[model samples]
Target: MTQHFTAPDRLTAKTGTQWWRDAVIYQVYPRSFADGNGDGMGDLEGVRARLPYLRDLGVDAVWLSPFYASPQADAGYDVADYRAIDPMFGTLHDADALIRDAHELGLRIIVDLVPNHSSDQHEWFKRALAEGPGSPLRARYHFRPGKGESGELPPNDWESIFGGPAWTRTADGQWYLHLFAPEQPDLNWDHPAVADEFRSILRFWLDMGVDGFRIDVAHGLVKAAGLPDIGGHDQLKLLGADVMPFFDQDGVHAIYRSWRTILDEYDGERIAVAEAWTPTVERTANYVRPDELHQAFNFQYLGAPWDAAALREVIDVSLAAMRPVGAPATWVLSNHDVTRHATRFANPSGLGTQLRTPGDRELGLRRARAATLLMLALPGSAYVYQGEELGLPDVTDLPDEVRQDPSFFRAAGQDGFRDGCRVPIPWTVEGSSYGFGSGGSWLPQPESWGKLSVEAQSGDPDSTLELYRRAIAARRAHPGLGAGSDVRWLDAPEGVLAFARDGFVCTVNLTGRLVSLPLPGRALLASGPFTVDGDRFELPGDTTVWWTV
Candidate 1:
């Protein structure tokens, strides 16, 4: 019933290197993308078929979320086979073919590597459960003898991210640890077999023509040696302690150093982006040194407020955190985990509102256009989520019954599922569901997205798709925006956030009121170009203007 997964016939498929500096990475959620073979879920062949579309979008790289073998407990995060692709998504041949296809279309492919844990049903875990302490596989995971009533007193007070006891009682009155869900058991990194197995997994994919990997939960690999109880945060959760001591241990860095050696064998060009959510910039930089990982996302920017003051603080924190490491910085305003920018930043009343009216849609289109400039204008490379380039807002009203993501489910009675933004993409304009597939989707389609399909907006010059194209072209044309690491915060009288790079200053009117700012030099870029004069530049509503020199 299983097919063999041999490493790709070709490993060095890419001729050119050092493509990360100015690259724009487009992230794809495989489940919500195009579904091939008439399956409701997206698969590898479907991603291969869409390579041309990504190439046309002018993105340099495409990061495919986990396609590895899974039980779909955590939507592929609970990997059952690290070396093979999930049968639901596709076969090994599809992965090999996908790499070649993506390369042919001038795109780099990065797959998610979930190293933190594995599905309880994984082979090793099954062996551990069957043989108990006598099994060689018992050491692969964290299993301990029980104490108190039904193993109620866990080794530690650390709570699972899913909101319950991190330890689960086994049939023999022992507790097995899982930082996420009971279905996913935490692996023992100190175990030699675990490290060797992970390295072997890396070699399997790297040899398979895959470009690189995006490591999931990079910091959560190694826990405290004795598995001590967490001590704080009682007021917040009425549960697990704030256990700071158990995380980011010194031994974790040693594991990363070893992984760097595997990457080194392939000429060290294969990039690894860490999903390291360590709050402080200084602590997060440990995973992104010259050897550990090529880059690590600083989530400070993702969770920052929409206003200027908070954003500026995040910018400062990021720069300050990375100043010592000498690694390139990365930035993004949105991702798969959080609320969509449209609902979070635009709506004051919250998620349930009439914000999808025709007028609201037009206004959102304009703000999205302006946000494009700001995203690209920042110091580092930008990550644009799927359909974000087309200004797709979170419109799908997800019913509580169909929620999928595990993070929201663990939130105890809270409607924590983020399936609202994970709705299927619209490929055609003939129907309300936009012909994503032959039948109903895993998510209910928003009526508002009927007119926003790629098919309908492809040739429209004023469409957000065209605006993204123009904005990307402009950012590339003037390298100063991406270059010139130094930024000078410019002072403006009104509620404006202004900055200068490479002798060029850009001022934005974040508020609805009209305002003007005097430019010392001639015009290079303007919000609504023809509307400006020689001295003072008048900015229309929620627009940002950039300069060349």
Candidate 2:
């Protein structure tokens, strides 16, 4: 049996305090979220139609992935026009209407801002190419002469994050740098024009009523002086674990500080979030200092294993690191970039975030639910990836021909398997796209997904969807769940984790064998069935429970 709670009223647009400090923000991948025009791809109108569902789901904000004008080279991350909406996604009028509709429903909007690079077809890049070498326009980007006698080799040894050399030679015999795909050219942040232009861009959107911006590749904005060589192999493996000349540079903090000042100028507690991948949690905290951005995504917690010890260590270290900066720690389980947590937990341990092999489905889902209970109980703001509430697993069997991830085409590239997690969500039990749109989905969905659709789970008490709704509502009603600074750890078995926050307690059992212990308090919620025996209760393996003393 599943517990139930009366759904809370719609969230207010802005709370009396800093809403983002402990808000639950949902990430909507626009390309696959919904489609209103039946064109098969999701659009702003599709998202507009789904606003009611999100409002009913109990999240405070919606963080939209890029919908800006682009050639779809790298899926809108490569921006050609920062101010215009992509034709496929609809017009500027549609964006305005969407923002208005969201606000009316008390949902704040956070748009993604990709400043680290721009589409090769952007006006600035085109002009730089036309003006040839030494052109003033070329100063806005990292264009340099190649090495060797004939200038045949790339300017430096730096490699593209998508595999192959980072430098691409132009017809004019000069090479340009791109950290990701060749179509996305890295910007020269040292150039004053880059800074001035982004400031103008920020004001443009803020004036249009956007609540905030999610800075993409936030750590890669400013490169090391002289474009030094990393002089290493398998460079992609070093990301988020070791420092490099091109990422997490000290100068990046200055850029965020400037953006933070602009954010402060706005009303309604507008915020800026950094999608920075730093080598350490302490270093990640640097981006969220009082004078800098409001929040940085806690990837460290997202990548932790299912083990109790590992999760506890990450929780303690993360909180300790953010305590000094006075920034609320952000917790996230799955996102657009990595494998879904539901599927990741199903497989064997040590696979980390990228798991290519399949695992036991039932076991994976059980642990995933247990993990969710644990995550929501922690003190801080939390991010819910699209479709995660439905316990959607990664669509791991997409054929190679249908795959569109740029990394998939390049050898030695970062795991090209991200497409597995970006499939359009199923909303109904039957439809060409499972109620995602009138037409077929851009990526094929499994036949088994019909059972997982929102329609299928709406009234079912044991559904994953219901669990999320209850958990979120519980979090909102309880004062100790969110915005707290720390948690008090309680003594438990080696593979079990128990903690208290105010009058609430969360206990997770990670071992395969059931454990008997004294009842903590009145049971508020449990991930699975439990057996009560006198003063003690038997907690099943891979389960979590919430208690209210």
The candidate that achieves the highest TM-score relative to the unseen native structure: 2
Off by over 4 Å in 2: 1-14
Worst 10 residues of 1 by lDDT: 1-10
Q: Residue 157 lDDT in model 2?
A: 93
Residue 209 error, candidate 2, Å:
0.9
Candidate 2 lDDT over residue span 88-127, tens digit each:
8999999999988888888889999999999999999999
Against the correct fold, how does model 1 do in TM-score? 0.89
lDDT values of the candidates?
Answer: 0.71, 0.90
RMSD of 1: 4.5
- How many backbone overlaps does candidate 1 show? 4
